[model samples]
Target: MGICSIKQMTTRKLLVLSTIHQISVLLLSDALTVSETSPDAPNSDDTTSINHPRNLATEALYINQNFRRMVLKRNEEPFKYDNPRLPFDEGDTDADSCVAYKYRSWYLGRQADGTEVRLICRTEHDGVTTGPNGETQMLTIKAFNEWDSRMASGVDWRSKLDTQKGAVLATELQNNSCKLAKWTLQALLAGSDQIKF
Candidate 1:
């Protein structure tokens, strides 16, 4: 098999594995929800306000459950890559390629803290020519909020700034890097920033 063919196979396998794992997690979560088998308690005659924490909790439970389903669906979609023909075979010449792909989703709501968290994940694939074979490297970036006991105690929200700031900074870096790398190459070859030019 040619170098590009081998690389294509490896990428296809990665995509399939990622998709299957995502689906399995969704199915498992669904099964857990249904198998609990706890009968719902009868509604009480006393009705206060819908804004109560208990009512909010019940609503949040359903929203979160549905959010997970949406996440799985989005992740399964094929992301744009620098090499549009990627995961494609290059007949021979040991091609040199660089590809970057990213996926992002955001949720805005109060969860103990007033600030909302943004979820993001990005993956980069870089392949270089080495003699008769092609060597490709894949790197992934994942970020989520972490609980900080110290911040939870302080009155000022700035105490938790580092954590939130870190996530934002990482996301910005990835976005900028991918844009720069893709554009730089296009400029070198086409003498312009436009991909088609």
Candidate 2:
């Protein structure tokens, strides 16, 4: 859209468009921050703005899609719904033939400097979606937490030598005890396909 000024455009949409055009730009936002719609639309950058405290299932869905290369399915013309440019950026995930999932992972995190900053994040995807051929495709994502907080080998977490004989999951669980608890609680409340998880 040459009509829209760069300052007036949503960075998320701009990145998607840029990726399509093979342009280089830093992505400072989550991939699925919103419904891939218009910048001025009420829900343009909307993140699960409903009455819930938070939800992240949809972000997991996009991650799963990217991993599965289901994003390639978006190259199909019929799938090109929201983007003004196509043949490059993956198109919208159609809700008519599948579940239209939404997400919310807006939160506050402390930086290395101990300053709290807002960050967009990812979470979960609860159910299955149908493909164009009516094939049932299940989206299961395990965004596992590694124990290291971007820390060096010796400091924040125990050295590899120290934990060499311990169970890996146990060490991670110890370092991310509260994070694991929160993730478990979210998965339980979401009633997601644990078998899929």
Candidate 3:
């Protein structure tokens, strides 16, 4: 009932209000995090399911196909290669007479949320040297996605061959044919919201 009691009451009220404000702020933060689905947002275990290799592969295919469609729609020509003996002459008979060639493809697509996705694939043919019967060769595949200036997931594979077999060397390339696709998908999903065309 005196001044000291009034001051004590005021101080208690202030402390309670502060505690309530802090609790509300924490709850609001949790709510925001749970609701956010953007690439930059923190993800729960469920959200991280997209990071699986299988999901990444599927995403890669989607991005590649979508990009191809975009290119075709724009009437643009994608890169192509048809010759087996390129960067080296068909008549080159030296043991080290190797010719290398690369083929690349790309596409662009917009996500449902309006994010732009870009995908690209590159295949390289190496050691194309002519022998007594035909040409010996090796192949490599590389692909990636670019969200704005940031390069996302990428994949690379090199061919394994027994060079001693010469022309008969049945080129045994460890064909990780899906590496590019997997990498592209990872990149697309990670940068979907952050990347700008």
Candidate 4:
């Protein structure tokens, strides 16, 4: 009777140990499977993973927002003239030949469908002048498609006049266009005040 009791106790211990071993094996296998299938897991065959479309779109949007902010900040600053004298300016051939000083500015705008757009304004002047100097300012306003990085289609306004009329028109267009663009960008970024009509 004593020998039988001892054998029974030994058998119970063996069973418990076996069960624990089996469970540990199962758990380790499951963990390995999960690690292998995870999205960030490294692949043995291919070193690089393809970028998901959603991720790409998100990255592009982030880039556009940053660009818009930079342009807006630059527009708020005052203009500076620091052009070095070029060899072409040294020749004295024509008296009426005016030195050209080019300036470019950008603004943010919104479309009818709640999409934000960027407007670039380029002006050329004969000398270092603030704002639009009469008879010497050539202005061109163009819309830029942020996503496409190309000039926005169906929106082009330009003026080339050497008179007070041109300056007035350019100033008016710049003020109106820049205001609209800046407002639109601000609204889009803040996700408030949707433009009506």
Return the number of clashes found in candidate 3.
2
Global lDDT of model 3: 0.37
State, as a TM-score between 0 and 1, how close model 2 is to the true structure.
0.28
Model 4, position 177: C-alpha lDDT score: 59
Worst 10 residues of 4 by lDDT: 145-154
Write down the TM-score of every candidate.
0.18, 0.28, 0.20, 0.17
lDDT of 3 by residue, 1-197 (tens): 45568788999899999999998767544321110222322222453575433344445545544543442323433223365444545676563312234544455878999987877543333212233566432322222322211112121112212434332211111123234344345434332211111
Q: Candidate 1: list runs displaced more than 4 Å.
A: 1-48, 74-197
- Stretches of candidate 2 off by over 4 Å are 1-140, 145-166, 193-197
Question: Which model scores highest in TM-score?
Answer: 2
The residue pairs in collision within model 1 are none
By summed lDDT, the worst window of 10 consecutive residues in model 1 runs over: 32-41
Ranking by lDDT: 2, 1, 4, 3
Per-candidate Cα lDDT values, in order, are 0.39, 0.41, 0.37, 0.38
Which digits, one per residue and each the tens of the lDDT, describe model 4 over residues 1-197?
Answer: 45568788999899999999998767544321111222332223432322332333344435444443343333344333476333346565453322233444456677899887866443233222223434322222222212111112211233323345555444334434543465365444433322321
Error of 2 at 16 (Å): 24
Ranking by TM-score: 2, 3, 1, 4
Give lDDT: candidate 1, residue 79. Answer: 38
